[model samples]
Target: MLSLFLVALASASLLPGGSEVWLARQWCQEPAPLALWAVATAGNTLGSLINVALGRYARHFQGRRWFPASPQGLARGERWYRRFGEWSLLLAWAPVVGDPLTVLAGVFRLAWWRTTLWLLVAKGGRYALVLWLADAWLAPYC
Candidate 1:
């Protein structure tokens, strides 16, 4: 469970990891599905919160030489956030865009409760789907 939690956390952050694969493997092992899903969701949500913190403070350094994003890029991100609003957090489970979306939520100062709610739903739903698929795929062999 700790390993699952860690993997989920890292996967949701800027770090590289694959929690879905870990969860699927754990699905065939001990511990209940509910526990696994909850742990993964919680960990992923916590990881996203890290991104939110980074986004919140990162703006202070936007124009510095060390800052990653250019002025135009930051402006573009702000525009995108304004256009989509906080509701776009529902896609927080997606691969490429999800991490950035979480950061964007922080950048725009979306309500913490709402951001977390969306993250829990999306992350939990993703793990549930993974578990379902794992069960179906492994049924023949078991």
Candidate 2:
């Protein structure tokens, strides 16, 4: 469970990892669907929260040489945020776009409760889907 949680957390962050594979393996071994799903959801959501914190504070470092994004990139992000608004958070479970969206949410200083609610739904729904697919594809093998 801890391994799943950690993997989910790390994968949800900017870090590079794939939690779905690990989750499927764990599901095969333990067969504890609910606990695994909940742990993965919680950990992934927490990791996204970390990105939110980084986004909240990222403006402070914009003038620094080491800041990751260029001024133009930041402006583009702001524009994207304005266009999509928080509704884009529904895609927060997507591979390439999800993590950054969380950060954008923080950069825009969106309401935390609303952000968290969206994250929980998105992340939890993702794990649920992954679990369902695992059960469908690997059930006989397991």
Candidate 3:
């Protein structure tokens, strides 16, 4: 469980890691799908919270002359946030854009509880889908 949590946390951060492989391997070993899902979701959610804090802190650095600015970039992010609002946290599982999205939520000062809830839904759905696929494709092989 500890290893699973660590893998999920690391994968959710801005790091080159993924818990999916570990999840599949562990499932193969013990077949405790529900437990695996819970651990992964908890770890991923906690890691995402870290990204949110980072984004909140980044607000302090924005608009400094030393930092580059692009109205186009800011505008695009704003448009996205406006369109999705707190629900945008669901996209927090996306590859490249995931971590940044969480940070944007913090920078925009969106409601923390709402953001956390949506993030859990999104991340949990992702883990469930991955586990389902693994069960479908790999179970027979195992």
Candidate 4:
């Protein structure tokens, strides 16, 4: 669980780590699958929420223009949010754009609960898929 939390925290930021690798290892070691999934999901969702909070309070720093607090950027994010709604968070597991997407959701002031819920779904699905694939490809060797 601690490792999963670290992986989630790193992956949620602009870092290059992912909880999927840890998940795959845990699965290969024959740990309790459900417990691993739950912990991974919780950690990932919490990390994403931290990013959302950063976006929510970004306006306080006038010099931090790179934080996506500008009016134009916020407007564009709002348009995208309206068009795609909560499902857009499904892409939150994607690399590069994933972390920023969550931040944008906060900058746009979308419903907090909805954003968090969707983010969890997306991230959880991603971890599950990765675990499944690893098991499928590596089980033959084991």
Candidate 5:
């Protein structure tokens, strides 16, 4: 359980991949889907919070060439933000664009609670859907 949380945490941060794979494996082995879901959701949410904090703090250093946020990436995220408004944070679970959206929300000083709510819905829904699909996929074999 702790491993799942930590793994989900690592994946949730700026790192790639997601907790889904870890989640499905745990579900199949132990069937503790609820506990696993909670851990993964909390860990992933905390990770996004980290990005939010980073974006909030980075307001000062964004223009610096040494900053890790790439210019192109920021530009793209900004465009997305402009197009969708803060609601774009709802897609925070999406790959490629998702991480940047979280940071962008922070950069814009968006309401953290709103972003978090969207994230919870998206991330939690994703886990539930993945679990359902996993069961469906693995059912016939098992």
Candidate 6:
């Protein structure tokens, strides 16, 4: 449990790792899907919160080419923010665009509660879907 929690936390942070793969492997080992789900969701959500804070405070560093919000990501995130407004946060758990979206939310200074609510929903859904797919289709094979 501790390992899973740490792994999930690390994966969700600005670091590079895949929490879904970690969660799946741990679920297979311990058979505690719910616990794994909670840990992964909580960790990923917290990480995204950090991204929001970074967006809130790191605007000065945006000139750099490799800031957390890359140039392309900033443009795409801006479009999403402009087009969908706060509702675009529902994709906060997406791969290519999700992490930057969280930062964009903060850059736009969106309401914190709304951001967190949608972020939790998206991240939780992702972790749940991973477990569901594994249980429904992979279990029999394993």
Please provide, for model 1 over 106-137, each residue's C-alpha lDDT reduced to its tens digit, 9 standing for 90 to 100.
87777788888888888888888887887789
Model 1 misplaced stretches (Cα beyond 4 Å):
63-80
Residue-wise lDDT of candidate 2 within 1-142, one digit each (tens)? Answer: 9999999999989998899999999999998999999999999999999999888998888889998889999888788877776898989889899998999898877789989999999999989999999999999998
- lDDT tens per residue, model 5, 1-142: 8888888777767988658888888888777667878888888888887888888888778789898667788777667766685777667778888788787778867777887888888778777787788788975654
lDDT of each structure?
0.84, 0.91, 0.84, 0.78, 0.79, 0.80
- Write out the backbone clash pairs for model 3: none
lDDT, candidate 3, at 51: 82
- Which candidate number would show the highest lDDT if scored against the true structure? 2
Assess the local accuracy of residue 100 in candidate 1 as a C-alpha lDDT between 0 and 100: 89
TM-score of each: 0.85, 0.87, 0.86, 0.83, 0.81, 0.79
lDDT (Cα, 0-100) at 59 in candidate 2 = 80
Candidate with more favorable, higher lDDT: 2 or 3 = 2
What CA RMSD would candidate 4 show? Answer: 2.5
In model 2, state the lDDT of residue 16: 85
Model 6 superposed RMSD (Cα): 4.2
Ranking by lDDT: 2, 1, 3, 6, 5, 4
lDDT per residue (tens digit) for residues 38-134 in model 4: 8888888888888888877874663574653477765676787788856767888898888888887776677889998898899889888876787
Weakest ten-residue segment in model 6 by summed lDDT = 5-14
The lDDT of model 6 is 0.80
lDDT by residue (tens digit), candidate 6, 2-79? 776777666655677788888888877777788889988988888888888888888777888767777778778777
Return the candidate ranking by TM-score, descending.
2, 3, 1, 4, 5, 6
Span of 10 residues, lowest total lDDT, candidate 3: 65-74
Q: What local lDDT does model 6 show for residue 55?
A: 84
Comparing 1 with 6 on TM-score, the higher-scoring candidate is: 1
Q: For model 2, what is the alpha-carbon lDDT of residue 3?
A: 95
Q: How far does residue 79 in candidate 6 sit from its true spot (Å)?
A: 10
Clashes of 5: 0
